[model samples]
Target: MPKLKVLNLFRIQLSLLPSSLGHLINLQTLCLDYSKIEDFAIIGKLKRLKVLSLQHSDIKELTTEISQLTQLRLLDLSNCGRLEVIAPNVISKLSQLEDLYVQLCPIQWNVEVLEELKGLSKLTRLELDIKDSKMLPQGFFSKELRRYNISIGDWPARINGDESLRTLQFKVNSTISLEEFQGIKNVEFLLFANVENGLDELQSNITPLFNEKV
Candidate 1:
């Protein structure tokens, strides 16, 4: 029998994939999204697999074996509700990785994880949806970052000192100061949603900051 090279097993209502899937060594893209898949060890045997998407699945933890697929480029786990831990060493081995979307995942954000990712030079885009503002990682606003999108339960007490950031999209409730816009010379787009402060106050505070730049 010929080997299956691609599979879109998403939304199949399956909690576990049959071990038979391991036979498809040539598989590249495997999407098990919206399925109740909580076990990932079955597909760990596929050495050539890449582009794994487990978004919206019930997966609680990512196995270390995920690093075996060195060719993986995009890994999306946007809504894995029970997810709590991410093995940093497993993720650091993916040298070719570019896009990582972990929004709504319950992974505990920590300073160590953020520092580790700084070594992932291939990462240029990041999206985070965290429920706790205190859980946010520091140095995430560094100049090396190109794009950032964050949705937190509360606005950060401070937003400034990022030099290379070009785009910033945030949903918060805290007041934004005019000084926060200084030193951000490349910012061309800014999106603030669900803010408690009035738009007029925000505009008044920001208009002067951008008058010379805009």
Candidate 2:
């Protein structure tokens, strides 16, 4: 319908969206959670879209067409295990984005993608993965974020507290200068996994948390 504002296509395993879907210019919220559809070329027509959920979808690449949704506030790509490429400059175009979720996806994190995220001044919540601590750029995370659940490295991390807390879990064996990450001071929950070196150096950096590493 031309006046449709919301569409919940949850759990529907379809290969394609009806061509008529593009006519919903006024559509505001679209939920495609757990769907198998891949082609999203028509989504760009929904210029008024505020929330787009593709959680558990079978999409392999997030095309640049999605950047047309300039009004989008929330974009969920959580559990998209097969997702790979996120078109360059696509995320930066979502200037109105407040929350973004890409956790549990295999997209290789890079400095360019991280820099694009930094441009989203309005972003308040984020959930994503980094293949390793070394992938993180200096001052990578935005201090504007009020809530986040970030896992760095290969070790699996738990999503804690229903997204109410800012957490960072690192599974690395190398030294990390905590000062490089501006958001560390705001982190409420932090975990270091498999740490084998620089305990003394780490202790000197954050005295309160490193009194004695057991």
Candidate 3:
């Protein structure tokens, strides 16, 4: 298996990737979605790896070695509910990262983390889970966002639209109106959570937001 370039361990029930996996210098894609991987210390040793998927994993931390994957283009960590901390400056080192998905994780972000995001010059698509909605005006949401899962206390005044935007989710706390979303009309998937009103009432409010656009 020295020449194996792709490894698919999706739901394989493995808790950790073999340190030997680092030996796969030619490996380009590694899929460990829904696996039990809690240790990825040697993952970055695969310097040529391009795509890594750890979706729904119980990942608690990422090693500093992850920064070695200079070719990394996509990192999927969606549904990682137990994830809490990430080694500082690890994300900022992936200068080639194009798409990063990190939804439903409870990691607390600091100023350095925010600064790292601002320096990702090649980032194009992002899926994030934020604790504050006010960060919108601070230049957090990008015009390049295509699919977003956001949980915030307030609705953004405006969502910059991109023809590529397809899935839009809002986990808000207050009443949201269609007028705030008039700029976006091409959304194919829409959702609302944690609103002040009941689900049915919330649906009624957003119906016009989507129906009129359709």
Candidate 4:
């Protein structure tokens, strides 16, 4: 009989767990949010991990061993204020990953990182709330992105041109020009948060824009 891993505790406050968590080779899901975990080396060893949520944690950085979890499908590190780096190679190995949310995390949105994410053909949804918009590569929109939520300092020159995007949520102060929405078709959801009068002109032209309630 295969062994069953047991890790069930809610809202426990611990600065860091012993490295012994690596022993749970059968661990498939791990949720350590609202905890005092300042480091993430212990969870890196769970080779079978698929779902990991570290929201609102005080973690400073992610270990390179995070790439070892090749089977990971969903990873949420939202609101990790101290996180500064995300290893490119580690992100590249997550070929099977489907959903990724890194909102409010300080990750360098660079060209290489964008290229690596584009390589992950399986990623369907991505939510990134970044402080700087210039760091995002021009080709970041090339991959088969289905849903995207981004906070940019300034809108990109253009969105993905070749493929069809389903949804786009942009948190910007400026209005999006009609040219930027050229290649996009059949978009079910479109959100422009914290905008000024930029959307007034578009509101009359953009056909069937999603409701504000959505």
Q: Which residue pairs clash within candidate 4?
A: none
Write one digit per residue (lDDT tens) for candidate 1, span 1-214: 2377678887877777888888888988899888887788876777887788988888887788787878887788887889998876777777677777777777876656655665677876666655554554554444354665545554443243244454455554453334444433445556566656688766766677677552
Runs of candidate 3 with Cα error greater than 4 angstroms are 134-137, 146-149, 153-214
lDDT of each: 0.68, 0.81, 0.71, 0.67
Greater lDDT among 1 and 4 belongs to 1
TM-score of each: 0.70, 0.89, 0.69, 0.72
Candidate 4 at residue 83, lDDT? 80
Per TM-score, the best of the predicted structures is 2
Query: lDDT by residue for model 2 over 51-170, one digit each (tens)?
Result: 999999988888999989999999999999889888888999999999999989989777787778888989989898877667677777535578889888787555465557778877
lDDT score of residue 54 within candidate 1: 88
Better of 1 and 2 by lDDT: 2
Clashing pairs in 2: none
Where does candidate 4 stray beyond 4 Å? 5-9, 154-167, 171-186, 191-214
| lDDT per residue as tens, model 4, 1-214 | 1254536434658887876677888988888876677777777788888988888777777678788889899998887777878866888988889999887777666657666776887898887665554455554544556776655554443233223445565544433443334434444556555456567645654554333212
Q: Give the candidate order by descending TM-score.
A: 2, 4, 1, 3
Over 144-201, each residue of candidate 3 has an lDDT whose tens digit, in order, gives: 4445444444344323335455566666544334455554544566656666668777
Regarding TM-score, does 1 or 4 come out ahead?
4
Candidate 1 scores a C-alpha RMSD against the true structure in Å of: 6.2
Worst 10 residues of 2 by lDDT: 205-214
Return the TM-score for candidate 3, rounded to 2 decimals. Answer: 0.69
- List all candidate RMSDs to the true structure: 6.2, 3.2, 6.5, 6.8
The list of candidate 2 runs beyond 4 A from truth reads 157-159, 173-175, 181-183, 208-214
Candidate 4 deviation (Cα RMSD): 6.8
